[model samples]
Target chain A: MERLNRKERVAAILKILSDNPNKVISLSFFQENFSMARSTLSEDVTILKKVVEDIGVGSVETVAGPTGGVRFVPSLREEDRQSFLKELCESLKNKDRIMPGGFLYTNDLIFSPEITNKLGIIFASYFRDKEPDYVLTVETKGIPIAMMTARYLNVPLVIVRRENKGAEGPTVSINYVSGSKRQIQTMSLPKRAVKKGSKVVFIDDFMRAGGTAKGIIKLMEEFESKVVGVGVFIEAKTEKKLVQDYISLLILNNVDEEREIIDVKLKNN
Target chain B: MERLNRKERVAAILKILSDNPNKVISLSFFQENFSMARSTLSEDVTILKKVVEDIGVGSVETVAGPTGGVRFVPSLREEDRQSFLKELCESLKNKDRIMPGGFLYTNDLIFSPEITNKLGIIFASYFRDKEPDYVLTVETKGIPIAMMTARYLNVPLVIVRRENKGAEGPTVSINYVSGSKRQIQTMSLPKRAVKKGSKVVFIDDFMRAGGTAKGIIKLMEEFESKVVGVGVFIEAKTEKKLVQDYISLLILNNVDEEREIIDVKLKNN
Candidate 1:
């Protein structure tokens, strides 16, 4: 490859780092690929660090010593985060979203790539400090957001299935009570999904009574792993929650089916 | 924000464009945010286009008209895509991934964020020209990759569920035979998930006899939508497939459970 000038070098470097979020790239990689001196590449990285921060999209961090390199840590600006959540809440307030039994229809929003991508960045910002080995979620509704969180954190995503499949080989299945439905539900995972003594963060689309969150805690224990953090897109107001200490972007106060009204608000706004 | 010089402007533009893949950003956006003149921002974008292409990451395109703007079209270099698929085939060759019933235990790999992110980019590259309105997939395993594909294409992801949920409101459910198992199965989707005359691309993790893909086509027909493209991570060797004209990354020849061997190879390599 031909050597690039400072302008080209900075753009190339930023693109590579942003592509592999939170995963460090050795200095030698840039040196070998761009055929530039160490000092020159260092200057390009320093310039990139300021450029990214100036844009308020993320930060480019430089690690020190052996095995150290630079990585891009994605984050949303505080005001941007708040306004995004506000807009999300407004979207959820549509009366048409209220279904039978007062259930809120959120598949269109939660399954959106653009929204989930931002949600992933926000969730990663909150849990990245925990240095989780994996991002975990139950199958179906939560996979998209959890997958995004895992991508931003540069970690593998482990999905717990609703039922054990023959394709999963030997599995660990556990029955837990659903706080909202008050019924026994089963969740399963492959035995080799996570390493023992590893840390994982749980991400989901909704939290109603927090029964699923509590069940996740028990499921992690069976693997000798830990759930260090939990994040949800929406949390319904209930008299009592099965678990506490979880972050939610939106709060669902009421979904009146007969009245044809939906009331949702941004959490902590 | 203060005016940034050429190097800083180039970096910022690339970062923003990459963040919102396939979404056009008007020049006024940069003019307002970076406090730059139109000519200056245009020059920076020209340089960024060459830099990204030279690095073999993707291309930056400028749309000309009243609502003209620039957008990033992401693509993996041919060699990189081939090598990535080769490594994936190698990973699948692990004997431990074989289950008792000749099923491959691929939950770990298919659920991986890094792997699926790349797979999404590749799928988007192939189908982007179709200008899909939505990227569709079945529940459980296909959500992650489909979400990524939708992200890269800047479209909403629509997931088909195995069973209808009350929260989805009125849904359209259909029963189809599992091509491999030869048993009847059901798939459901919200009635409003797709607009009439919209084009969609189907993505999934594996295809045994293409029964599910065929089911997607029939389901889309109910909404008056069209299935423009189909992509999968792996395609198992079958006597005959139920669908044709689809792209697959890998081909599975055989899984010898008794001999503890797995035979897989890159598709069209």
Candidate 2:
């Protein structure tokens, strides 16, 4: 490898840290790769930290001790978050998105890689203090956002299946009432999925009565794990929620099928 | 904003490009953000490109013409790809992973964000030339990897459901036999999900007999879209496959429940 100047070195360091968000890359690893002195690498890290802060994307923190290293903590700028949430609300307000049963067709939005990636970072930022061991979500709609959150947090993603399949070995199935449908539904997970006493964050695309979130709480109990946090993209207006203390990016006030009006806005706006 | 030196400017530019993989960012956008001369910004990009190449992660590509811009094209170095796939095969070969009915339990591996993130980048590298309009997968296991691939490709992810729900508005449903189970199953996708004449790539965790892949091909036909490529993490040994010309990372020879042994290896190794 050729000798790289400070400009090139900073760019390389940022790229590596950004790729492995929340995962520490040892200083020795960088030193071995770049063939730079410890002090020089430290100076480069300081410069990189300042650059990331100036850009308002996130911050680079240095850990102390034997395993100490540098990590990139991702964050969305305040103004960027506001504008993004507003634009998302505007998109959801499109009348065509309202279906026959007043369900908003959010498949395109939720499945969008760009949108979910940002939402994941937002969710990660909110739950980073919890130091979650895993990010959990049910099958289908929530998986993308949950997967993104896990990626940003540098944790594994655990998906609870709607039903038990023969291939998953021994499984634990739990029955929970659907908040909106008022019907009993079964959700299952492989017995080996979550570790005992692990802390997990639940993330999903929508929440109506928070029944699923509650269900997750009960399911986590089977493995002796804890649901430290919950997050969703949209929370629909409901008379009551089964669970509380969850972050939602958007609130859906109402979807008027008759008038073809959909009222959605950023949460707490 | 404070004026940034060359090192800081290079770090910021690299961060932006890395975050928006494969999505072109105009030179003017960088110029406006950095408040620097176009020539100077170009020099930073050039330095960043050389730095990325030195690191062997990927390349910074420059597009020409009126819509010209720079984009990050992520790639896994050949050695890294080989070692990662090899490690993945070893993990799968654990005798405990063999469940009843000769099924190998893979939820932990497929659901892992770190593993799936790398798999996504590898898949993106393979299908980037296709310029896929969307990365498509069925509900459940494949969503994580598919989402990652879409993120890396800078495209939308479209998930097909096993059953149609009222929330998706109008949907097109089709029945395809499960290659391994040899049972017919249904898959449905909303009409608005895919655009006409667009190209898409199908990604999944496992492929046996390729029935699901064949079904995806048929389903895409309903929307007048083309299935340009297929990629999977594992492919089981079978008499034959329903579809041809797909990429599989690992080849699963057998899962011996009686002997508690699993035989899996890297594809074409």
Candidate 3:
């Protein structure tokens, strides 16, 4: 195996901390596994502390107690976190990643290390920024992106099933208009999935009419938690007013099924 | 703007070449634009030549005439290309990136800079292996990833539409079973979109039934081209056998709508 450099080593360490959320690990644990010296490990951790501040709600708290060593408490600047995530969205904005209907292909981007790495960084950044209690999205397609986002944020991403999730018992549902369906569809979020006052970021793959995003907004109201922000792969710019404080990698302004014209451009990071 | 290292500089040059698909730029143009010395420019060109080769295409080439400096012929290796993309995929696989329904959120991953660097590297690696002749996908959701894949391979992504595109004249469409609908839906491709004998890599956000992939397959058949492979973000394993010879980053096997049981695991690169 190849040895890691200081930066790669530090990145790896922070990633490790970020991975095992809500846990404190001894610096010695990393030192032993990496076969790195204590001083070097300490320096690595220091670098991690500094870099993570830019992108992760991530902090390395050194514990002097018997059980404490270093604990990562997610926290970071929203600008830094947004910048961190903007990179992933931009990469997906590449024309090559563009799929039909001017959609940005999250499936392919997630499979790529570069895109996924940014995904982790973005999530870690969010963890530092919003400390969202949970992640939220609509079903099927939104599942993957929401999972990834939640994983990074070290929170669970809950889905609002458009279709009945039989196991959730009698569910709470609301009807909202979908641009695709051009009508109302029943959208549901599990009761008690999120507590009141909890913060959340809503994520979905493609937002056309944004009926789904709005539905989730109503669902969040039921929990009394704030919708921290909204994120999407492809935003149908026509629905710009669907939500305030939203981010999208690519905005689909014009998609003509007859003309076959797809106008795609990068959105604010 | 900050000055870049040799690797980033070289990658930037390749991007310049690919973006100008319709025209060829002489070395002098690059030299004048970057304000670099001749020897440095030559070395950069050499590195770029190798990068194009690594992406599995000969699209980048050198013209011998005085007016000729360098050009991209767009040839590459398919297998190496997809593997190159593994880096981004692996990065996205971080548990932190998981949101809900075994889904991964990649908006930030696609937009961030440092993460985009990793994404660029992963994409370059995948393109080096994939060397596809054309990028393919269904409209709307798959665009971003497919566009990125198409870009790394230095090829144009041809979308298969589910509805008619008026500008393209009469569209060609086929019916296939959708895992989402469990019923046949009409899908299409432009008549002149792809040439015969072309090699294509099918890409999308999520794969449930493989029906969409199969639809792309049938659409490509209209042009008598071969479907090289399918790449996706999250594969609901239960829906496997929807298409053969496909790859994905995550596998979601146990989906229990009632219990909210969603098990996601990373796929081998």
Q: Rate the local accuracy (lDDT) of all candidates.
A: 0.91, 0.92, 0.60
lDDT of 2 by residue, B1-99 (tens): 578898998999999999999999999999998899988988888898898889988999999989999999999899999999999988998888888
lDDT of 3 by residue, B1-269 (tens): 13444443454455456434323578888776566787997877766554444333445566777777776543324454455455555565555544455444454443222232233323434444556777777754454455455545556656666666443434587887886658979986656567788888887767887888888887788878888778776677773466767877567665454454445666776
Ranking by lDDT: 2, 1, 3
**CA shift at B183, candidate 1, in angstroms?**
0.6
Q: For model 1, what is the error of residue B72's alpha carbon versus the real structure, in angstroms, after optimal superposition?
A: 0.4
Deviation from truth (RMSD, Å), model 1 = 1.2
In model 1, where do residues sit more than 4 Å from their true spots?
Answer: none
Candidate 2 lDDT, A106-141, residue by residue in tens: 888999999999999999999999999999999889
For candidate 1, give the lDDT of residue A175: 97
Question: Candidate 3, after superposition: displacement of residue B208 in Å?
Answer: 9.2
Q: Model 1, residue B116: what's the lDDT?
A: 91
* Residue A225's lDDT in candidate 2: 97
Where in model 2 is the C-alpha error above 4 Å? none
Tens-place lDDT per residue, model 1, B1-269, is 56678888888899999999999999899889988889988888889889988998889999989798999999999999999999998889889888778889887788888889899999999999999999999988988889999999999999999998767788999999999999999999989888999999999999999999999999999999999999999999999999988999899999988888888988883
Q: State the iRMSD of every prediction, in order shown.
A: 1.0, 1.0, 12.2
| TM-score of B-chain for each predicted structure, in order | 0.98, 0.98, 0.63
Q: Give the TM-score of candidate 2.
A: 0.98
